[model samples]
Target: MSSAQPEDGLPVRRVITADSFRALKFKLSGARPAAAPADPVSLPQPPAPQVLPQERPVLAVPVEPPAEPETVAHEPPAPLDVPEEEPPAELIVENAVAAMPEAAEPAEAEPPAEAARPEPAPEPVPETAPVVAPEPPRVEAQSSVPNAGTTAASSPSAGFIERRVVERPQPEDPEAGKRAHALLDIMAMPTVGSLPQERALANDTLLRLIPRMPLKSLRHLAERVCVMESPSQLLVRRLINDSRIEVSGPLLEQAMTVDDSDLIAVAASNNPAKLKLMARRRIISPALSEALIRSNHVETLLNLLRNPGAAFSIESMWRLTRIAAGHPVLQAPLVTRHDTPSPIAFQLFWQLPSELRRYVLSRFLTDSETISKILTMNAESDGAPRKHADHSLLSELEVTAPGEAGAIYAELAHVGRETGDRIAEDQGGEALTVALKAAGLTRAQFGAIADKRADAEALKAIFDTLSFNKARVLLTYWDWAARRTGPYARIAAA
Candidate 1:
């Protein structure tokens, strides 16, 4: 300690000096020096106690002891309350003491976190209600800029970063595409070669597997087979020249099991070109030839018929005539033959109206012969084409079929040929009227065609052929057309 002036009125003490520090340490520990025995010399007697002021021979009596000579000992922190299932409390205390000096020190400074009393410790919990522990807060790592300093150690480099590129896989058949395209090119050609060319083409070519050689190509190939032409020879030589496939299935089957019409209609769609005319040929199927005659398919059918070097047969003529008779378009170009149509074909023929039957039969047989054929054919058929027996003509004459009787009158009225002899009788007016109206024509048109007015003969014929209602219908039509024009003007409303 020292005294000074002229500065602020504060006392100065050399507290940090070595002497003070030594004194502090000595006082802090309060440990006295141990005295040694006097040995053989008698120990000095204890000094008599003296009153401090009365015996004041000492210059300064240091009265006050060091303010805190007592050491400030800190209490050890209490052991934590963990479950017995866990390690013992003493082990936890030992662990914490080993981990952090602070954990053990704090309890000495304050009180143990809890006293180790046998009675349960006051829980580190609120007194009133059990607490719900909150979860520790999470922290997200933000993406960083380049040169980001990572806690992760630097990556190691070995053969991993030093490897070479890998090889890719190869195809199974590399030239297959070229072969396929080449085959397509050959198939695209228009024709096969001539016969010798055909033999060459068929002998060794890729085309052998195809059962049908195209027609145009077959034509060329047939020529080559029989004649032997140019490079056509060389090309066919490289083609199917070595191969053999079945070729007789068509002709053999045609000769054995098949007949004519089936041969045409059924096989035609499949092999029309092959079936075309061959000179002096007997056509097994002519009806089919004439069928497309009136149909829109006629063009394709005709091409098959007019194969230039080939001619058709008697059977073809029979079939053509039969079909042409039915179709108005083919009627002009009649083909004649003498096969004498089968009984069934003739049966159907005579069953039709006499006029149509005569027209058709005229082509097959002479006029007189056709009439006799019809007579014979009629005798054999199911009587006559069906008739409406209750007709007006029934009571007056024997004829009952509306169609048959209609035909008779149609002739007498239109051609004025006096069909009267054959007819049951001159027809009644009602039958004639009905027959005319039902035949689908206006009275005027019928009159103009017949070259006569609705005369007594016409009236008789119409009534004779008609029912009461059919007759009245005709009369009504007359009334209507006349009112619109005239003629039936004779028959007024009453």
Candidate 2:
């Protein structure tokens, strides 16, 4: 090193010479030439350490010394004769050695470069060993850059940089979606374009298989079958009568293929859920209506009564009225039904709550006189023997009369003539109230002929307020239903 002064007169700056640098490098590297032996021959020198310019010299000094030097007697070499104007190389070398870790001194005697590559060390350079020294950290550092993937990919532990080959998802087939939709469309069109024999075979196969189908499959089939315009009759009947309402409900509600007999069979079942579904059918027949009434389920009965599509025989209405008289819940729907006879409404009147009773009276009573006149005129014009009798005289009669009046009363009691005679002989009881009211007889006239043990006042109240046309219609239905001896006949007889 040499010191020089600037013209600007700043502090002295020291400049390093090439020879001093080389001496310092050889001294710290543990490869200084061995001291001359007493013999004239010179021993081979270990390879000099090579240090990277970028790395500090302290890290490069820790290279292992050669094996031959370990056995040799040690002697400090003569110092280089530096100029008096410059700092000595020995001072720089000693300072660098002191800064190195003390633990590296034993390692200074073993040549790591020769041990790492013993095959052809004739080139005698230790640069290859130190070059690999800082490689691990360099490799680790390079991993942080984006492009380090190419270098680190060879290492198994570099999981984050691993390149995986993923197959791109194949495009979905358009026909696959179309085919899936076609499956549902095919389900709706079960019987399209088939031979009669084929259809029959298909139907028979379905009938046998449907009963054993899982509940979910059966329900799906049933829901699908019901909406088809002309679904197989056997299949429809099977599903309509399924024990599970979930399987049968859609058929009962929407299937047109279901016959009235099928519905009657459903009504006969103990399943109130099925009975309710049957009652909710559109355009229910009178027979089916009677069957539903016989079901004796309050919900079924209420559902039937509320369904405007349900057509009740006058007998069914009578039976339903008796049911409503017992179940207050059945009253409102039974009374409000448009198909329900006004006579049945009148019968159900006392059983209803105040609100319903008011509705019945207002609905059935307003047109009583006009309805009575129309009925009488229709009967008289049909050439009935009673036509010429005075309705005004009959309406005004507040007391009982005999002879001609008694004969007229007997004639009125037998309005169905032969059927009335049978009913009367069978102890007509309530039938007589209906009969007398149908004849347009007054409350007092009805009282005179009714059994003395009977509740005359209650019967009179019904007769006074009864719709005349409705009563006559009930009378006709009773006569017809009595011959059939239906459940309604028993109700009428009661």
Candidate 3:
């Protein structure tokens, strides 16, 4: 064993035996010393507790006491012996094996007395109990019935399921018609005297109510409101043109306030009935009659002609006469009209039916000279010459004086006779024109030549060569002749 010293060390350590060195080494390593064996006589003993063999063993966990400066001895806790809650019966049966601790000796265990008490029996239900339905809601009665006039049949009831009885309203009193008429009278009065706006409103109200009124009421209202003196021109005009003949008749016949322009416009409509009604007015202006005539309404023209108060211009009369030719219904009125021009009357005479022709002949053709003139004029204008020439009569006339007049008459007479049955085949236009000019004869005399000849072709030739004025006269005559003979006559002649 040796001892050694290191630098900065003041003392040297001595080496010991191996056992002692090992013991010291172990002490330096901070390890616990080995426990010594206990002496049997010094050991303490615990008291014994008795337990049943079949009982389950209890498992307890040991707990250590907390450290304290002053240590006190604590007695081991007495066995708790507090009874544990028993598990539910169902659980006991289901887990009887698992819930119980195993015993050392299985032969010592006891069998369960009975299977788990049978589950409690369920309560029984009765079969005779009646099923009660819920009661319906009650409605309170109304204190009083509502007035028939105040309640409407169409009004909704208060509740969705509730029913209501509605009474019908009473009819109006019997004097309702009289009351309505009186009201209408009151409304119509303002249409004349009130402001224009008020008048318009009154007129509108009257019109709205008029359609609902009876025929008698409408007539009465129309008579009172549609007069010329009234200020309601709009109402009067509406009434005048109303589609109802009764409503418009009075206004058309006597509405003096109707403007001439309005009358003309109505005439321009060519509504024969309305125009005829207007023609019956107390006084129709020439302009109005002219417009009426221009409409070419046959009945209207007849009405105007029959209206003594209506006057016509010469041109209008001529126009009316031309129109009257196609309308046999217009002939009688035309003939009877005092205002009708002599020429127009004469012209219409040929178009009159055979019965009316007598009156025309007697009235217009009083003398032989006038008869000759009319017949001659008619023939010339008609462009219808005779088929056979009467040259014997011409030869009987003495041309005592060889003057231009006598010479022209003789030449025209000769040419007319030459244009006999074969005149239509002959080119007599130039000859007829030369003869007429040389004769210095009027259109009447020229027409007579063509008429006497009985050749339409020759007449047309003569007409073509005549002056514009003479040709027009001939055209008018031809038109009259065509009408005088029926359409079949023209077709047959053709």
Regions of model 3 farther than 4 Å from truth: 1-208, 226-228, 346-393, 396-494
What digit string (tens of lDDT, one per residue) describes model 2 on residues 221-248? 7777777777767667767766678888
Q: How accurate is candidate 1 locally (lDDT)?
A: 0.34
Ranking by TM-score: 2, 3, 1
TM-score of 3: 0.37
Task: Please write out the lDDT profile of model 3 over residues 188-247, one tens digit for every residue.
Answer: 564446566665565576555554556565666667655435446766676676667787
Ranking by lDDT: 2, 3, 1
Clashing pairs in 3: 380-447, 385-454, 385-455, 386-453, 386-454, 387-454, 408-439
Model 1: worst 10 consecutive residues (lDDT sum) = 103-112
Evaluated at residue 408, the lDDT of candidate 3 is: 32
Maximum-lDDT candidate: 2
Query: All candidates' TM-scores?
Result: 0.23, 0.40, 0.37
lDDT of 2 at 382: 51
